[model samples]
Target: MQFTIIKYEIIVVSFVALLIFLLIGIAYLTLLERKFMASIQRRRGPNVVGIFGLLQPIADGVKLIVKETILPSHSNTLVYVLAPIFTFFCSLVLWLVLPFGQGHALYDFPLGLLYILAISSLSIYGIIFSGWSSNSKYAFLGGLRSAAQMISYELSMGLVLLCVILVSGSFHLGSIIESQVYSFHSVTLFPIWIIFIVCILAETNRAPFDLPEAEAELVAGYNVEYSSLAFALFFLGEYANILFMSALSTILFLGGYLPIIELIPLPGILWFTVKCLLHALIFIWVRATFPRFRYDQLMKLGWKYLLPLSLSFLLVESSILIIINPY
Candidate 1:
């Protein structure tokens, strides 16, 4: 049927567009971090490649692609090669459920949030695979640290998300944004949002919590044995995850695609982007400001502090919701 052909065409086009956008976004996020850190350190980050180093990422990509991909002599070749590919794929796929703007997702299933959580949990496997396949003690140790770190923080992140889901009474991301339009639960429950965002930082293994790749301790951590294109894939995946988490934060806490003021006429996507960027900058800023947490310190924070607080808040939010709409 002509209609079916057209639908397929649309799907293909959208997929290509999304893929290109994600790659470009990841490329530039690298530049953004460099530029930001440069500013903090009172130096220029990149200024040679193309107008203010605009083409640096492109150049970097080319260099990585042209360089040799070294496989460790004793490594499990297939799994070692597949590790970064798996990491990159897992990072890119989660966008399918993420609503960029109202009705903007490639597929907006009712339980899209659950899909994201599940996929996020899967990313740890890639790290574990990379570490184990390397046959290097350093890489293996780094991967173990990252795995334990992610698992611990994920519990708290789930609790926070559960509270938001209960408050909105929907697992649909669009519905969650819509729920925010009037009540602004993110604002009313600011403390919970704070805890949620910090847990996110840990979940994503950002600074102060970046134990997985702690340079001084683990010599670049889980992907340490990777080189050239394989390493590039890990790099791309990491930045993509950062942006993805920022976008998720926007949806859950910052009112996704919603205007700061009703009177302002702006595209919802633009508002969504600005919010996402703000969340992203927090990731970068934290990296610049905080030193890495000791592994024990990090675990204690997640278990002793965040988990209990989020659980208590979840119960309180549920009780209040029940009282308000007891039908």
Candidate 2:
């Protein structure tokens, strides 16, 4: 009983530490985006807060917390308040099964990949509920768009994961990582990697695929009615999901927690983080480089193009797997 109590206490402490680390990561990711986009546009970024705007995220957090939270009189107050909380909660919980390195994950669930997919699907509900509860047409339309967009792209995403699982023969994230020891899937399955990247961009509501939150059409999308800390929660959740997807991409393709050179003495966790950061930087770069896709075009690309491509790859992967390991 004493040992069990100590284990539970350790789990709680580790979770709290991870929560702080993740929140810090999300905050700096926003700063990184702003700085990166500024350089791309040849404009000065947030240089007023701290050295090179290091403290900008902190300032923004304080401002949001202290500002008045405006509640829409006609909105369903309970759901209105709950939506962003739920969204942020879902985003944070995804880290539970993420393996930072060999023997380094918080909880090494055998079905970690499936858990990630399941939790990602649940993230859509927060958006839908926020839009419906807001009692606004624009927000409602935005929510509907997000629902359709996520659902459509998720099919392709799932197919892509199926291909990976077929190749690795295990749903466990760590086992999947270990399978890439000899050769990274990014090199072998380059086309699938490309499709996965596109799917994740849409999944995280990033630019080009950000049709649901299109400023011109949906105003501010499903979170249009939110302000102050409510708005901040949505902001944090969006970035958190982006980072999560980036980390997932690293695990899937870049050889999670693996060093590029066998001679290098770097820690696996550091290598994993470096790979994830590169992917995250790619996210920001794509935002700077591409124009937003029109809603119809986005849907057509996902359903018409990506879905078929992913399905084909999945079928090929499965056939090859069966041939190689026939019982």
Candidate 3:
């Protein structure tokens, strides 16, 4: 039917547009991080390639693509190659369910949060595979560290998510954003929001929590053996996840697409973007500010500290909701 054909065409076009938009965002995020760090260190960063290094990310992509992909002689050829591809794929697909603004998400699922959590948890496999297939001890150890680190924070993050879901009373992401009636921060649950933000920093492996790729310790961690395009994919995937985490935090706690001031008038998408960018700045700032944690210290913080705190809050939140609503 002509209608069916039109629908299919729309789908294809939308997907292509989404892919382009996401890739461009990730590329600029790289540039943003460099420029931000440069400001902190009091130097110019990436200024030569184009106007203020606008084209630097594109040049970097092309350079990586042009370089030779060196496969380790003893590496498992299949999984080693597949690892970064898998990681990049998972990272990109997560954006599908994220609501950019009211009704503007590419795909709106009822349980979008659950979908994100499930997809994100699978990322560890890619890292583990990359490390194991490389046949390098450092890579293997780095992968192990990542696995353990992610699992630790994932527990706390899940609990954090539960608090949001409890407060919002909807699993749908758009509904959660809509529930935020006012922006700036959650009116009643600001502490939970703050905890969730911290949890996401660890979830995305930003600094203070970047043990997996601690340069001085793991020597670039699990992706060390990856060169050229493979390495580029891994790099892009990490940043993509970072942006997604920021977006998620915005949606959950910062009031997605909502203007901070009740009187302010701005397009919903612009507000959403500004909120996401602010969160992204926090991510880069944390990276610039904090020292990397000792591996044991990281585990202890996640387990002994964050996990219990999130759990206790979740329990308290649930009990309060029940008492208030009891009929």
Candidate 4:
């Protein structure tokens, strides 16, 4: 009984630590993205708050908290209030099963990947509910678009994940990372890596796939009616989801926390962070470089292009593996 109490206490502490780390990362990621985007556009980012704008996110948080929240006259107040909370909670929940490095996850489950997929898909409900509950045409349209986009891309994303499961022979994220640990001549395979990157981008609604929140069309999409701290929650949740997807990609594909060359003695978490930043930078670069996709084009690419490609890749991988290791 004493040991069980100690185990429960440890679990609770670890969960709290994970939440702190995720919240801090979300805060800083906003600053990093703004800085990168400003440099890309040849402008100074947030340099006023502190040296190099290090305190900008903290200042923004304070401002949001102090600002008044405006609830629409005809809004469904209960859902309007709960939507962002749900979105934020769903985004954070996936971290519980995500392995940052070998044996460094908060929790491990046999179906960790599927659990992530399920949580990601459910996050759309928060967006849809927010839009519908806001009682505004713009919000309704944004919610509809978001739901469609998420549903369309999710199919391809699931197919792509299946390829990783096939390669690793396990749905547990820890086991997937373990499979990627290899010697000099035995590097991680390439095809699964490609699929993983593409899926992560689509899953996070990154540029070239950010149809739901196309500012020109949706005026900020599902969270159009949100203001002050309420809006901040949605913003934080979106960026956190982006970071989570990037980290998941790094873990599943590029070998989470495992150095590319393996000669470096850096901590595994350092490698994990570096890889995640690289992925996040690629997302920013794409946003800066590419135009947003039209809704139709976005749906077509997900269903016609990514879906078929991932399915075919899965089939080819299975066939090759069967031929090589027939029992």
Local accuracy by lDDT, each model: 0.90, 0.93, 0.89, 0.83
**lDDT rank, highest first?**
2, 1, 3, 4
Task: List the candidates ranked by TM-score, beginning with the highest.
Answer: 2, 1, 3, 4
Candidate 1 ranges beyond 4 A from true positions: 1-5
Model 3: ten consecutive residues of lowest lDDT: 182-191
List clash counts for every candidate, in order: 0, 0, 0, 0
Cα lDDT of model 3 by residue, 1-327, tens digit: 999899778767887898898889999998999999999989999999999999999999999999999999999999999999999999988988888878887777999999999999998899999999999999999999989988988999899889889888889999998888854445577877777777788777789888888889789999999999999999889998998998988888888988787678889989989989998999999888888889889889889988999999999989998999975
Off by over 4 Å in 4: 183-192
- Number of colliding residue pairs in model 1: 0
> What is the per-residue lDDT of model 4 for residues 164-231, given as tens digits with 9 covering 90 to 100?
78778899888878787773112444665665666667667778777667789888777888999889
TM-score of 4: 0.95
User: Which regions of candidate 2 deviate over 4 angstroms?
Assistant: none
TM-scores for the candidates: 0.97, 0.98, 0.96, 0.95
Best by lDDT: 2
Q: Candidate 1 residues 100-201, lDDT tens each?
A: 788888887899889999999999999999999999998999999989999998998899889889888899999999989875656877888899788889
Q: Is candidate 2 or 4 superior in lDDT?
A: 2
Name the lDDT value of residue 304 in candidate 2.
93
Cα RMSD for predicted model 3: 1.5
lDDT of 3: 0.89
* Global fold similarity of model 2 (TM-score): 0.98
The candidate with the higher lDDT, 3 or 4, is 3
